[model samples]
Target: MMEEKMEDRNKIKTELIVVIVEKDMSGEVIDAAKQGGADGATVMYGRGSGIHENARFFGITIEPEKEIVLILVDAAIRNAVLCSIQKKIEIDRPGMGIAFVLDVAKVIGSPHLNLMSDITD
Candidate 1:
């Protein structure tokens, strides 16, 4: 039936994983994701605020720096990638940054995939 085919196709859809972590941990986080199942990741600088702010030892104020990593992966590997990052970064603790998965409606510009049209004239 048409519905059955649609459901099967959806199984291979892609998703986006967003990880915000301490600036220095971004590299390790991405590496763990790649080892788990993700093909690649894009990281960028960012800043965030939460209940637990950094404490200053002296007169200077220290705002923690953060890095955001975006990873687009096949839905099949979403869970594995998330777990790998969490295990590597020890995200279970309170102050560590957060990570979430979003259902990606579409993806583009990834050079990692090679497709075959398979059309004969």
Candidate 2:
């Protein structure tokens, strides 16, 4: 049936939202993402363990603070969401943060329905 085919198509395409923000800017980044049409997001705090020698300060340890924000959106609005967060959070600045997107194969839950409804319109 057409409905089954449409559902199968929807199941194949997904938006992956990845945001790496300074620990202090996580809240602002998440708020910007929400304003940009993200239905929900997950935030995790972590310390940067980059192997770059320059990543450290004057012989003392310089641990870069980090927060990772993950939001799974419908494919259509992924770019807009990324741009909105970038604009509001100034992610392009040095040591500020970074955000990227990926393709998702499938997802499970009622939340996907809500996201699909919101993004389709």
Candidate 3:
């Protein structure tokens, strides 16, 4: 029975939120997610677009500042992290940034295995 339960737990799906924000605000975003109970996160520099376009002054392109933060969390904490990020980053405002969730089907890492070990016992 314990073995079966562990297998089931391993099969459970998790959600990952990929957030892109202004370079300066990345720390606030990460802190918000941590307060919301995300286990871990990864951040990197990136560029993206939406309804807004780059501003131009005298025909010079004004590149918008950007940073990408990827957070992997169990499904149970998805909503909390989402709401916290939205509130902290003011994603509803223009030029703020965007965040979206994706399904993580499988995870491979010793940490993940250790996380499941207690269930197997």
Candidate 4:
């Protein structure tokens, strides 16, 4: 008979950076992520509807085109990547856009994730 043991997956932590910015500046955003040590990024188009305020003309709606960037990076370089993006995009300024990081408990499909974890560890 063979015995099997389960691994503790919680020990591995990853960061998912969600960045929303001007559609035309998505290339810059991805560049920032790469400069910050991110291996890859995914970008998508979207529209903004934040609580800040909205302008209207003739009782019509106006929405700004946005690019949503998704970057999954190793926990070790998460902060550095975010800072790099901030410096290049001036994320601190109003109307620039919003960015946030989420805790990724698990990831799949990316074979290099293990290599990343090992290097960071």
Candidate 5:
């Protein structure tokens, strides 16, 4: 019974979508993702050292500031969310940004997810 319950709980697979964009773009990205079916996102500030990201100032190189947006959503909507983000930001263009998806093995401490599972069960 426990095994079956676990399987049922795990039926809704999760995916993590990570978007790295120029500074101050996280809000736009988050809005796009939400429009694409994502619930929410987490944003963090970072710096990039890519060749195109470095700017020379007074003979010194300054790494471009970046914003990392992390969105976790059900696997079923990953593609739609990615497409929405691409449409909004043109992430494919040079220096625009980059986005990737990763399979999430496990997730915890998410009240909404827990509530969803309870409602489904």
Candidate 6:
């Protein structure tokens, strides 16, 4: 049964949707993602050092605060969620931050996986 469960898990493909946005905008992005079929997401605080992150005042460097949102979803909903995020945040604009997707080979002990299985079954 253990091997059977592992095989079932393997059959489910997953993807990670990563969105980096200004700290204040994280909530809006998460809401949009949910509208697009995402179950939920994990957010973390961070600082950006990219070209757009450079700001100086009184000759002192400033690193803008950022929020990194990580959302794991079934591969089937990846595109829908991405599109919804872009539509809400307009990430394509300069200084609006970025969003990307990564293929997840394996996911262990994630409630997101269980949710996906329930939906599929």
Candidates' RMSD to native? 5.9, 5.5, 4.2, 5.5, 4.0, 4.5
The candidate that achieves the highest TM-score relative to the unseen native structure? 5
lDDT of 4 at 46: 88
Q: Report residue 2 deviation for candidate 3 (angstroms).
A: 8.8
Question: Which pairs clash inside model 1?
Answer: none
Question: How should the candidates be ordered by TM-score, best one leading?
Answer: 5, 6, 3, 4, 1, 2
In model 5, which residue pairs have backbone atoms overlapping below 3 Å? none
Q: Residue 117 error for model 6, in Å?
A: 11
Q: Give lDDT for model 4.
A: 0.80
lDDT on C-alpha atoms for all candidate structures: 0.78, 0.74, 0.78, 0.80, 0.88, 0.86
Residue 24 miss distance in model 1 (angstroms): 0.6
* 14 Cα displacement, candidate 3 (Å): 1.1
Q: Worst lDDT window (10 residues) for model 5? A: 112-121
lDDT of 4 by residue, 1-120 (tens): 111111333355778999999769889999998999998799999888886646688999777788999999878899999999999999889989889999886665665555222222
Which digits, one per residue and each the tens of the lDDT, describe model 3 over residues 16-73?
A: 8999888778899899998888866788996655557577789997777688998888
Candidate 5 per-residue C-alpha lDDT over 1-121 given as tens digits, one digit per residue, 9 for 90 to 100: 8667666767888889999999999999999999999999999999998977778999998988999999999888999999999999999999899999998777767865541343333
Clashes of each: 0, 0, 0, 0, 0, 0
In angstroms, give how far residue 28 of model 1 lies from its true place.
0.8
State the weakest 10-residue window (summed lDDT) of model 2.
112-121
Q: lDDT, candidate 6, residue 41?
A: 90
lDDT of 6 by residue, 9-108 (tens): 6788899999999989999889999999998898999999998678999999999999999999999989999999999999999999999999876666
